[model samples]
Target: MAQINLQNVNKSFGPGVPLAVNDLTLTIEDGEFLVLLGPSGCGKTTTLRMIAGLERQTTGDIRIGERVVNDLRPGDRDIAFVFQFYALYPHLSVRDNIAFPLKAQNLPTEEVNRRVMDVAERLRITHILKSNPGRLPGGEQQRVALGRAMVRQPQAFLMDEPLTNLDASLRADMRVELKHLQHTLGTTMVYVTHDQIEAMSMSHRIAVMDRGVLQQVDTPLNIYRHPQTLFVATFIGSPPMNIVHGRMVGARFVAGDGQFWVELPPAARQYTQHDKRVSFGIRAEDITVGAPGGAGMAGNVVVREPLGDETVYVVSVAGKTLTAKTPPRIRFNPGENVSVKLDPAAIHLFDGDSGRALLPEGWSKHV
Candidate 1:
């Protein structure tokens, strides 16, 4: 197992140009499953490549478990990488492809055979050992690709969206299999995915990046519950968090339409020395829906979708529109009026002008 540490690591394409990874400092624990999540061109893949020595860092140092590997080549570093596309040798059989790394290391032929059989059997692709990539389905090819990586038994594994091309059913099945494999191997795994669902489900911790900046890093639940910035609050959750322009009315926070009020506790109300134009954030799940009581925020049910397991609602609340998820199969027809309530504990307040979280220095997290 390897614990990765990056100190002031930065990468750029040209001299004196904008950096692709800007002063990123992070510590990934040994045996931890960390997912790097962001949109395309957000520097996630750049960071992963740098770790594998595929790309050189313009500044700072990279350490893998006490050894500073800044000058080492990719082959010299003990890392196994699984790319988005299966990079298997088309002419080689699956067993040969999985045994390639062991051959490179000049290991005993019997040992190579043993490791290949073990991982292929575990991935449920043992039956395809004699087949080539051209004859294998996408899912089977992915397993072979992963088995090839697993054979080396490297200190760490780096996966760059290896399952992005699979079907939905295959994606679900593989996710469960991957999680189990990581646990069984007990290896340090760094995964990259643009899908938040994948990051949320597979990662022990998540690192969120945007515009070449590392925004936040924390446990999946902590990151969702305590987003450090407006960018993270908007990016990490499904259906996204609902944010609206509002003003602080003494102890209460009211929306721009002045129809709804957020009941802030005394501590939360006193969070700011004096900041106006606040941005209020609440997740779709935090909103409780009901028939318009004529007193709450003015809204009409614009759309309702029953997904068998739960109902997704699109409500035009106040001057802005927002989405909510609920389980009650209430027959509130479309265009019917409805009222919405924001849970006190679920409400997140930020500074509108600066777009920064506005709270006491350390007690940003409230009871």
Candidate 2:
């Protein structure tokens, strides 16, 4: 296992077209599981391709371990790439497909058979070694593809949305299996995906991107609790954070048109004096909904969605709609007047003009 580094990377298709990746400098530590996460057209796949030597960068230095692999071919990079779709041969049996890479290197027959059987047993596919991949189920076919990559024992593994073809339940199951596999093998992995849940659940650190630019890189909890930008605040969450357009008035944030207001925490007050126009952000779970005429802002429930264990409520407060997540036991109906309380300690503040977070001094260094 080796650490991968990219310095001042830039990828552009042509003179008139926009760049696919821009000045991306990142390092993937040895034996680390790093995920490149973003929406479509965000250059995550391009970055992965560059690292695997499948696509060359217009200007940059890419080093895999101690070697500068800018001129090397994909096969010489000593890394295995698992494609999104299962790329298995129909004519070949599962055993032969997993052994194909070893055979290509002209290894001894006994060594090849031993390695294939070991990987098959580890993946629990030994029973299907004689079956054709074309007839197997989607999950089984994926395992075969993974087996093919694992048998190589390369320096690292680069995967590009490897589980996108599976159903929701299967995808969930595979996520757990893949994380366990990575931990057991202790190899460096660079995964590319647009799904936030996959990134959140599997990665040691997530590199969030947008329009070919890196947004933030942090652990799952830090990324969720303290997003560095507005884009991250809205993108990483399942229900998304509730955003209210407002301005800072003294130590309090007053909604536009002067309909609603909330006090800022002591730490946030230091930065509020300079930036008058700010956007107030709070997570769905941070807002409390109760009966009307309480010690909080007054609002009316606009819609209610029951989601088994929990319910999500759409509330209209001061002519602005905000979402609140609550337990299913706490029931409320549409058009019902309710008291909404915002947790000041859990609130996030962002500069309205720049869309950057307004955080305390040196707050980002800890994470």
Candidate 3:
């Protein structure tokens, strides 16, 4: 329900130790469902806790809407946090559990009942109203936790992998439910998850973090198709992007292994001028594997994984390994020589040593 902003935020566990969060600055728009995605030890959770006032930031300031809340307690932030581990009162019935937070505030019994049932219905947990927390299924108990948060109708929702404890099928089901729930309510939700799929499907925009630094912030498709860093490129996809050693040859990019052929997009070639030893990156899904002559690079199949929906092929050319994915119904096996072609427009070029993007022609005026 509010926009949040961080300015020069800093946190450290001790002197000389690495900053858990390093001069972090970000903005969360009102009613935006933003997801903080990264692997373990990435400081995403540390950032979330800092926002909630649950973890004190060693430096900088945090603001919700128009007011700075750095001096406020967690309870005063008007935000709800749904963590991985549901902290429900085991002895209480679902109805009582949902009403517990209100009870703590000493609300009248009639008002408590009104808030509890309203939240239960909103989360579709009305049927389990009377069941004790100990008797509920993981998914049901999850709803109770969510309902408890919903009871307050707080200004923001911070969920940190709340679906991590459920079975795969239930987790998937709950993801859909949660998406719909957020859509219907339109609250400012900051969800933290290591699962890229969850982040991709649920977020309006995603902030990717790594080793205490923010990597790239964009829509899922842009992050997938145009990652700003080598780490982001490697971390976001399943099968991952294939990065190869190569050098610029006049207008062409020749693989370092000395047998692969590549053509650069006319637009990308502008950056290749006066630079050699660049890193070429392409996604597994973007590479095309074929026989000796198919208007693409020539290669040989070395291995094949026949997944039900698509086939994954590992190809070899000049002793370099390249992965290509195609429709599962079409199959190819190892030991057979092949040719591959990449979509020139889809290729990404990186500064070999720096792992930073090479600006295309007309991109950097001084280049």
TM of each candidate vs. truth: 0.93, 0.95, 0.93
Tens-place lDDT digits, model 3, residues 1-367: 8998999999898998888888889999999889999999889999999999989999999999888999999999999989788888888888988898889889999999998988888888888898888778889889999998888888999998899999999999999999889989889999999999899888899999888888888889888888888888888898989888778887777786556657676667777764487778889888877657787867888899988788999998666788888887766678877778786667878777777767442342331
Candidate 3: worst-modelled 10 consecutive residues by lDDT: 358-367
- Candidate 2 C-alpha lDDT tens digits along 18-94: 89999999999999999999999999999999999989999999999999999999999999889898889879999
lDDT measured at residue 160 in model 3 versus the true structure, 0 to 100? 84
**Model 3 CA lDDT for position 269:** 72
Q: For model 1, how does the per-residue alpha-carbon lDDT over 266-312 read when each residue is reduced to its tens digit? A: 66877643437888888989887787784456677899988787787
Clashing residue pairs, backbone N/CA/C < 3 A, model 3: 297-340, 298-339, 299-338, 299-339, 300-338
Q: Name model 2 segments beyond 4 Å from true.
A: 361-367
| N/CA/C clash count, model 1 | 1
Q: List ranges where model 3 is wrong by over 4 Å.
A: 255-257, 359-367
lDDT of 3 at 94: 89
lDDT of 2 at 63: 94
